[model samples]
Target: MDFNQLKQELFDYCEEINVQKVGIASTDTFDTLKQRLVTQQAFNYQSGFEKGTVEERTTPTKLLPKAQSIISIALAYPSKMKDAPKSKKGDRRGIFARASWGKDYHDVLREKLNLIGEFLEEKVEGAQFKAMVDTGELHDRAVAERAGIGFVGKNCNLITDEYGSWVYLGELITNIPFEPDEPIEEGCGDCNICVDKCPTGALVQGGQLNASRCIAYQTLTKDFLPDEYRTKIGNRIYGCDTCQVVCPKNKGVDFHLHPEMEPDPELAKPKLEPLLTISNREFKEQFGYMSGSWRGKKPIQRNAIIALAHYKEVESVDTLIHLMKKDPRPVIRGTAAWAIGKIGREDAKQVLEKAKLHEQDEDVLVEIDKGLDFLKVHTTT
Candidate 1:
């Protein structure tokens, strides 16, 4: 069995399946990543979405006992959408980050990884494999960087020469000892755009992120968004792309190789007002296929309220009031209360006062009071 020939064949197979790039890495423990993770934990910088302990994350052998090599794959997604609808006055919209533009990338990448696994199974008897995507314990960026798939940029994204950072990464830890590829030695080279432009200063420095402060992470939380980020989140309902959008490396690097990764403009930038009152089943039927919907509709709805506030969409004020009065969830009710305050129309104070009399939740009451505060100066003028 010639391992070198098999490696070439794997590359060919990846091309046949439309996977943008592929590389091989050894099963050695990621010592550097383990130390960085320690710092991230000490600073409470983690997004709380990470799976597995530090040991399990760094040691591929822990995931697959006999793991001899790891194969890293990249699938480039479009950075720009064609015929995207614009967000206008009465019909304001919330934007989903490019990653959520198409079908859930997790499903797409997993299918590709499974195809790779089956191909190897056919070639090597008893070839064990453990596949991983973004959700997997092992850091996809770390694995991809080590595998020569790309270099880790200042934004902590694996950046390939062909695709910039607009790539979805996945890996397969296998017992096959494929020859390892050379790690890319490139870097961001003194570019501080992403860090400098991070909305909430989530990028503590280049490559270091305080996930709790990141708009993207904040958008996924099931609670009220911090007040400081309401304006910064702008129209973004799912993820923040300020870091990637500002990075010079990503300029003009959009790739539309996979049709499955293309954006449906309507879904990617859906009307924010409709999102406020969307039923769970309706949300599932419309957006469940997108990766951004993984957190379900609550966060999206909350962010939509925030986006309405960002735009001060006066037309949605009544709808916001309905949610404040009728929604069962405190987070949604409280968020809508906050949005009403932020939008401070002439009748807002009267509307909020009426809701305040019926509100039971202490937290919701606090938000209602905040809403009334915004109305004091608003109504007087």
Candidate 2:
């Protein structure tokens, strides 16, 4: 069968199996785009990289030699609870939809991709397949666009007719060079809502992101945040999705029922008090498999403290004080100091003084001052 015939058959199979959208493209497309990603200043350099590894660069072809064509798929996970729920108000939670709240998409997508790979091998004669759910070195967004799934929006998310920007993507690489899929026409048009809505001015240009300024990266990727960007990071515990949430195209999509995507309730509308209270063992049990678990409890815990600080929610002050004094993780202690500043309580002042005396790290001391400043302002007010 020709490429078109094969692509049509694949799309049909996806619909039959309850998959939302599937698109195909040649492997060479990713090779070209990978080079482009490296040259762009918008890319955030990964923490550990001396030379060439997956961190430095990625090559899909190296993993799947027969990967002549790639099949990309998208699954939507829209929120069941409308308007992002008000668990911890004043902490924006930064618009992360249900899609990102559960187990990492890498694991979820890989399971589905592998299932599809097995099915393809059975249906198509002499077809050999391998799959990657962000593990292999492929430019997934570019592949999704090539497959006609959606256009790359100004927010850098793959936007689809059915799910808007609320979908997750995964791809399977195959040696069977089936018919190539047609690329969709770019749909961003003259709209720039994503750029305007970004709080940190992270969107450097059309479809470009400065990783340093991005709230998602700031909260999740950076181990130590520079003071200048600390206030801008907001209260996002993990990833940020403000760009997609405000996009005009993402209106009226139902993503709660996708076969492969569902939000874990704890993550969807997390309780800041409970999150702050969770023990390390419980933390591991609850989030060890989820997307943000790789960073462990420190970053997320720090974020919760920041959220409390941002809101001046003095309720968590005791929790913050405990974290400041006893938490072995210095990052958490430092952030707790910042939260103390936000709470601006006289009690917090005492804690901050003790933290200042005991703190050896220069960075942590700076955070103590920030907390003290908040108290100063509170006293003056």
Candidate 3:
């Protein structure tokens, strides 16, 4: 059987299926990635979300025993939202990053990968394949890079010429000995825009990231956010795009190729006050379709509180006070207490004093004290 001809056929099928980019790579152990992972682990720079051991992550053969080649696919998502709603003074809103704008990419990419796997099975008598999206043990970016889908940028994102960094990546590991494509020669040379502009300095160096300091990572944490990042997170509820948004390579790189990836203006940038009080059922009904909702409503609600504080949304003072006193979650109650203080309403001291009397949680009391301190500083002046 002519594997080269079969490779071309697979490529054609990918194009017909509307996959934006496709490339083939040999199933060689990723030595450099293994080293980097080890170093990242030692320095505590790794995000705990990573799946599998370092060996399973870097060695394709471990994922699929007889893996001979890997096929990488990328689908471009829209970077620019059309007719986005404005975050007016009284009705301020928070944004989900561009990656989370549309329907979840996991479901979309999984469907595409399954299609490719079926196609390969039909063509080859005994084609064995394992497909993976972002959650798989194998690093999607490493596989994509080796497959020549794109070069890894300083922001640690895979940047393709056709779609820049605004793309969802997936891969299929198969026993077919498809010829590997050459890695892209392009790289971010002396361009430090993403590094310089990272809100939390998550990008330690060009290609390394301290996920702990990353606003994207911080936004997903269930606990109360640290004091320093409460203001720095701005109005982002899920994920941070400062590094990607500022990259020159991504300039004018919006793509609307996939209908499922189109953003709904109101949902992607919903009003902050409503989010603070959104019931779990309502939160699910409104945001369940989006990828950013994976962490559920708590983190998003927490970020919403921080965003209201960032704007000093005086209109939300009443809602903040309600959350401070009535919310069941300690994190929410504490975050609301802090935000109320930050907003500094004329009666903030009174409300906080009342909350202080009944608050049982030690952490909530600490936040209430901080709120009173803010009032104390303002009242004396």
Candidate 4:
């Protein structure tokens, strides 16, 4: 069987299917990644969202027996939103990271990977394959790097020359012995923009990331954000894109290839005040299709409250009071209390005092105290 010809055909098929970039790599244990992951765990730097053990993540053979090769694919997403709504004084809007600007990437990439798998099955009888997107056991970026799709940038993103870092990556493990493509030999060199500009110093040194401190990871957490990062999160309702936005490699690298990947201006940059009281059904209806909504409305709502505080939007004060008093979730209630304090409106002290009288949750009470403290300082000055 002429495997080289088959590889060429596969590449053509990928192009026809609108896959932006594709590359192949021999299945090999990722020694460097394993060591880094182990060290990250030791330092408590992991985001806790990682799916599997370090061994399971680095060894492809463990996922699919007789895995001879891996095929990596990238789909470019739009960096800049078209006709983005302005965040006015009373009606401030929060930004969703560019990665979540459109429809969920996992669904889009999975469809492409399934199509590739079907193509492989037709070409070779008894062909076996396993496909994975971002959430899969195998680290998609590591697989993409080994497959010669792109070089792993200092920002820890797969930086392709064609689309820059504004791309979603996925991979397929297969028994087919396709000729491996040469790995990209590029490096970030002396540029330290991403690391230097990281809000919370999540990027330790260069390529290493302390996910716990990453605003992208922090935005997805269900608990109250750490005090240090609360102000740092800024107006981001979902993920943080500081590192990627600062990368010199990503300059002028916006692509609107897939229609499904286009952003809805209102949803991607929704008004902060409206989000505070958005019903569960409404939240799902508007944001369910985006990748950022995977963690559900709690985290997003919590972040919205923080965004209102960041803007000091006094118009949102009434809604914040309602959330602090009436919200069933303690995290939301506590976050609202904190945001109310951070905003420090004239009536905030009175509202917090009323809620404090009945607030049962210890965490909520702590946040209420914080609100009162803000009022105390405001009164003194």
Candidate 1 residue 258 Cα shift, in angstroms, is 0.7
The lDDT values for all models are 0.92, 0.72, 0.93, 0.91
Residue 56 accuracy (lDDT) in model 4 = 88
**How good is model 2 by TM-score?**
0.87
Scored by lDDT, model 3 comes in at 0.93
Which residue runs does candidate 3 get wrong by more than 4 Å? none
lDDT of 1 by residue, 280-338 (tens): 89999999999999999999999999899889989999999999999999999998998
lDDT of 1 at 190: 85
User: How do the candidates rank by lDDT, highest first?
Assistant: 3, 1, 4, 2
Instruction: Give the alpha carbon lDDT tens digit for every residue of 1-381 in model 3.
Output: 999999999999999999999999889999999999998999999779999999999999998999999999999999999999999999999999998988999999999999999998999999999989999998888899999999999999999998999999999999999999999989999999999999988999999999999999999999989988987999999999999999999999998999989989999999998998888899999999999999999999999999998999999999999998889999999999988988899899889999999999999999998888888888888
Off by over 4 Å in 4: none
Using lDDT as the measure, name the better of candidate 1 and candidate 2: 1
Query: What does the lDDT read for residue 76 in candidate 4?
Result: 94
The residue pairs in collision within model 2 are 3-179, 66-175, 341-371
Clash statistics: count for each candidate: 0, 3, 0, 0
TM-score per candidate, in order?
Answer: 0.98, 0.87, 0.99, 0.98
Off by over 4 Å in 1: 379-381
Better model by TM-score: candidate 2 vs candidate 3: 3
Candidate 2 residue-wise lDDT at 320: 81
lDDT of 3 at 322: 90
